[model samples]
Target: MDTACGKEYECMLRITEEILLLILDTEQGNIRVSLPAHTRDIVIAGAVLMDLAMEDRIDTDLQQLILVNPIPLGDDFLDPTLADIANATDTHDTAYWIARTAERGEQIRQRAINRLAARGILETEGHGPVFFSRLVSRIRRYPSVDGTDMEDVHVRIMRVLFSQDIPDPRDALIVSLAASCGVFDSLLSGEERAQVRDRIDQVARLDLIGRTVAAALRQHTPSARSRKSARPHQQIPCVAGWPIAGHAFAMSRDLRIFLTRQYQRHGPIFRIKAFNRRFIVLAGPEANVFVTKAEHVHLRSNELWRDFDAATGSGRTVMSMDGPEHMRMRKVQAAGYSSKVIQNRLDDVIDITRRAIDTWPMDQAMSGFPALQRIVAEQIGLLLTSLSPQPYINDLTVFLETLLKIQVVHQWPKLMMHWPRFRQARRRVMELYAALLVAHQPENRRHRHSDFIDDLLELHRTDPQFLPETDLPVAFLGSYFAGLDTSASVCAFMLHVLLKHPELLARMTAEVDALFDRGTPTAQGLSELDVTHRIALETLRMYPIIPGLTRTVSNSFEFGGYLVPAGAQVIIGNTVAHHLPACFPHPERFDIDRYQRGRAEHRKPGAFAPFGVGRHRCLGSGFAEVQIAVTMATIVRETELVLERPHRPIDIKQMPLPHPAASFKIRQVRRRRASGTV
Candidate 1:
């Protein structure tokens, strides 16, 4: 075909776009799971080459590729490959160009998807939330914006495959590309494929470009065994354990201990099986840096939290979204959940802490975790929405903990979500949020201080499509729960550590008393509490509440000489650095001075990640830290904490979130500062 003549046969979707549409599982919105991810890249590269051929920019015979015209296509995806072929001085075969282009498979795929999204034919959206469905939310979905049942390329391809009608040259190329990548294996079953076998081969021969693609891919595509042996990337080492159970029992017994041991034994990356599911663990300081760098590109978190999103009745949460949607929601809630919010309202936070402390019976052996949880919940209420959560603390705790266990942890049965206790707790928590919504109304809070809820309401008013009223509960509740679980547990651990070591406790006490000795605790003054700050840092490092992040590999990446492939479910062991002696000397010891100026072990990249790492690194890390520091300072300054059983070892409850066990009780033996005093 001549170059000018080929331009007359332009189709609705580009060859690359048509190939994408055909290979994509319409229901899931990602490339079909049955197709290897790399193969998708190779197919896309081939599509670019096919488009170039259609434009008469290039031509291929049985083996060698001939560059007829060196001109650009003006299309982003096609132009780059056209330029690459034009720039080459030496002659190369079709397989050479395909391999060269496919080397940038991730970039090519993303660019094609981005262009498709920009054209408005397809919209990028998350799996909103299904009640009990197994979610693969990690991969993105692109449903047609028109809401029509018929997908043009898919319908057209099937029409050609199942019938005797001849396919157009474009459709023939798509058929060839799909077959070359084994996409037919996923789209058509063995029986269906068997029926279409002769037709597919017949259609694939219609275009010379299609025949070239078929031949190049057949000759160059390595078998699974050859690819494994040829490439330096080895299989991730799996932790030795039983067939089905794997390390579930060991992990359930003590997660931190098991993870630390694995890091030491297996080095950075390894795999583990829990029940029927397998997870690859990326550990140590290097893994932390790798995750921080790769999070937005290669890893994602929304798929892991879809059940939690559904259980919240919000359909989606900021934590359960990726790409643009996640960023938009995160930006709306950023200022409201920041540490500056706590810094501005230091007096209110201190007052809330003091009042909660006063409620603790003076000489009674009260449970540490629950007591601290209630106090943190109260502070979150006052600071976040300017509404007290005091009455609904128990209800909120029950509701959040139950959903976490059932949805996030997968420890409890999903049916537990329907239990009456959870039902009532959820109702009460909703009532609390309902009250918050009412309290933040413009007329109701005319003179009241604007808060996180007010910001959410403002965003909803401006962009309801993005921040719908239905999602308000999760928007508010997400921030509250983050504090309730992570910040509260850190405070409990601080209490445990302080109670365990009298000298450290006394040093923290003196630091707190000195901070209060100055008029009011300014953010500057709170930040300067070196001993107290180190204790908080040391506590977080020693007792990380959320140890590792569970994510799906969005793009295949190489780490420590092993290739972590796309579509893998992985646990990035972010806290592995905290326990590694290389990152911190004598990591097991309770040494607050590791964070001191001279040592500053936590200053290293990936060495200290109590707030997690990467783009999803907790937005409220500053808030959590200040909350812990101030709460610890207030408690130490006001009353003395004595462990109920001083000699008993601190028992850890590791499921859902790790925290000091209820048996780790503390009683206030001395009151240095009265509840109502300055």
Candidate 2:
């Protein structure tokens, strides 16, 4: 080969790289499983042989593989196989060399991945999932679920398969290699595969190396039953069930503890059937990594939340949508839901928090969770929706939690929606929504600064099809609900931890006092509450607000050698890793230092997913953190609260969501200073 031509070949993606990329399910970070196991290995081996032939190191005809130039290419993926072929004492056909090379498949696969990562074609963020990209820069591109911008191989292959253009020898060889391995099964849908099958066959016949690869793979292909039997003889363990209740009773008793026990016993992946709804439970750090890397391709959220969508009376909410549509909707509200939104209005938030604290009767015990929730609801309204939640807080709470209990958790009967109190609450909340809609219309908002509602209103006006008028009420209410509930839960938990650890409380108090001494807490000042920040993170690690997420498998994938097939319901125990001693040393202990620079345990891959993971990962996570820290700081600087008299240990109550039991109360010992005096 001419020197220039050889350099050109060097610049081009190698046949091995092309084959690996072709078979990779980029969205899932796994080789496509549409074909049986080890097919890619054979195809990749054929690629190595073909590359050798092209380089004049070997030649192949219908009957025999002939060594031409015995010199090695020095390519890691090809050199070993080439040397074997060169040193062979006896001659053999191409099929013999292909099978022998296939034995090195795992090593070949790893080398290709390492090369890809080195080339910047693939990237890894920290210890997170391998990310695929076609873009040249280092920016992270999370490809859309349906498909991403087609990489060069995909684009090239599709162009050749669908058109009348004559194929290049290299293209023809790739087509044959892919055809032999059934890669088209995944790269194309059924209709597309049928359309291109004849063309593929014609192209496969055009290259002698391709034809030999095809014949060999066809002869070696395992039968369907044998292939099924060949899969690893392992099954995900199932939790013990009780008659018709399945594992429902145990899950209801305390899901976090139950799941933690299951993780301890069965490791990360297991099965639990509850109320005729069987779920494949994925727990611990490893499962988090798997889901984070593959969720966009292998899981869908709409199915799991369909009942909640129906209960909303609106067609769909952002929480229930997936793929590009979900992304589009999330973009619509992204700015409004950001921490910057909360940060920009820190004073208003602090004011609302202070006012709520002032309402507590002096020296009297109050329900901690509900009291904190009410305060958060008020702050969420003023800052997010420009409404006062005081009049409608009870109504919003009752209406939202009732629907969540019935529709999301399946804790109550559908008939619970019609109970008189629920009906009253629902009616009041609808009225509240209606009022918000009217108040936020373009004309009515002349003087008011834009909030989340304004963003929705503008979108509804501009793109009715995208954000229809009918969806506004539910969207508005849902956004409000998101801010109110989780933030309060985190705040309550942070408070509990602070009270339990008086030394930590003292440290936090000292930190807050220092912060307040810097004048009114600016976003910059609030952000610098390092000790307080660690406390908040540690609290979240110990008592994650949303313990786990429910999803439905949209595509079949193997986890720990067990096939979690398509259409299975899954419970992602995302926060379970937080409690694992492997992920966090002495996890039950409230040690804020775990987040310190020396430890930094949460920085480990999938070790800390308090906001869950992947596409549906909590977008408001940053906002929640700031809101919690700010609230905790404000409370510490303003009032002295102690565990209520006849102190009872914290007990979690799970229904709509996990929160400290009603008996968990706090009494205000005294006002440390007048509200806002700090």
Candidate 3:
């Protein structure tokens, strides 16, 4: 431990050599790595990562495990002498020495070995160690599989430890366990994901092992289904625009008006300049058919999502994926989110929503985003992970916010990958995510719940071969992240808009009261909230979370008479498209009346896509509507909200958020029971 003689550096170099010995246990697998040969260093590098996993310091979800290959190692990079590192015990010491003396291979080898050896699980020759053996034994004893073969268990445990999945019968059990422990999703390549698929098939092929298991796992595979080609879209006027940015762009309202003019002036289709890109805004039903229904002609929502990011911070989410890969991932994640699953957990969401809404400080002015974030996280913990953090709500909100900014807002430096800011953001997001995996996973489940985490863990255990792993968590996280802020803001907007126009509020309150008098706001009660639903829809249309959706043209295609260049990006303006007067009479007005009980005819087909459309449309739309409807109903039922600065010309400088401080106070009317039920 003494640094006085500067012998610490010399002492540190020897530990890496010791660590390498610990990583190689089997007689046949052991290989000499300290030599100056080029291949020798590379071999050492390969063992480093596996060694790290064996010790369990890093979880199975190590995100960048793929980076281990094309192993960056050489003799020059790993020049540590055996004498210099011999007495230096501990992984950090070995890593430091390796880092100091070795450039690549030695550094990796030292880090990997030390990570393991530091934990006191030194490798044994031709056998498992006391600590590792004990851990593995305990895991195997956990009763995940009833009849999975022993050899199969051993092989799977071995494969799982190295982040390689074994296809033996026990993989289902092991995968479930890994997911429960907050193991990160393995950054599996297409091949690895496929290999897992085949292994599951093998298990299914085993006679009388139970027939449905393999098929179940197969359902979760990204490549499970064969996709059909998109049908040819009917010809409609498809105008394209490539406008160079002028110094003076139109105001937000002007842009909205301009888009309306383009739709009106150009008939069914036209194009306009938006921000830095040229948006090809279309009108009429065919526009919807083209953008949403057509298969290969996928709708892009990045532009809309950017505005969303401005509010919710969710651009990097898996929901941001596009084209075939995007659709595949969505389908795999969707398998877990079937109606049966939702119906089973409807009560849980309702309970959580009620508590969250009750906790919403109506007396004092506050931001709804933080509270909404809590609901999102709570749902994720219950629905996906089965373990939601209670005291760390604020921290979780900030973390989610941080992820959003790092991803959606692109504020955390790494907006551009080449920039140092991006590097910092990368470090922050990765570290935050790793810490979350560790934090959410407490040992031996004293604090477990029947949440999504439990569901996934159980399924993964029962059918690891078919499990989507952490994608459920990711999807749930994404939905809440993608949904909460915007929905809450819409709720906030609705509250503001209604308060400004008390007649509308009175009508909504009466509708809710009528529905309540008949029965609780159950599935049937929501059907009666048609006027309320219209008001909600109109709010979404007028001040949609995103301005438009965009897609990068992946293939050369023709829309109407326009030959859209293959690489060109397409923009579908939702907000503007909604405002086109030809589509909606008196489009500038905030008329909830358009969708009211007496006036339901205004909802035209293909005209009202508040949540976008198609395969990748918001999966949480139903959930979000319930949340918003419930929250809005609760606030209206129990309190009267009043905007401090009463009606004058309230100018919305920002397109999405009317204002930041956005203060309001609510007066208690009467206490209502748990009246709303999904």
Ranking by TM-score: 2, 1, 3
lDDT of 3 at 458: 54
Over the stretch 1-678, how does candidate 1's per-residue lDDT look in tens digits? 423234343424467876776776544345665676668778888888887887788889766999989877677778888888888899899988888898777667667667666655443421111011112122222333343222467778899999998777677888988887788998898999999999998888777778887789777664432433222334677789977888888878877678889999988888898998788888888988776645766888888889887777677777887765765666566668778899998998899888888888878889999888888988888888888887888888788889888988788999898899999999998998899887887788887777888888998899898777788887877767887788999999999898889999888888788889986799999988999998888999999987878998898877766888888898878888898888899988989879778999997867988777765778777778899999989988888889999999899888778888879899988788876986
| Whole-model alpha-carbon lDDT for candidate 3 | 0.45
- Which regions of candidate 3 fall more than 4 Å away from where they truly are? 1-244, 247-258, 266-285, 295-317, 320-324, 335-363, 368-476, 514-521, 596-603, 648-678
Candidate with maximal lDDT: 2
Q: Which residues of candidate 1, in runs, are more than 4 Å off? A: 1-234
Steric clash pairs (candidate 2):
none
lDDT by residue (194-275, candidate 3, tens digit) is: 6555443343344221122112222222232375543233233434433454211452444444555556666655555544
Ranking by lDDT: 2, 1, 3
Give each model's clash number.
0, 0, 24
Which residue pairs overlap in candidate 1's backbone? none
RMSD after Cα superposition, model 1 = 12.2
Q: List model 2 lDDT by residue over 167-245, tens digit each.
A: 8878888898888777888789899998988999898888776776677666654243243332331367878888888
Q: Please say which candidate is ahead in lDDT: 2 or 3.
A: 2
In order of appearance, the predictions have TM-scores of 0.67, 0.71, 0.51
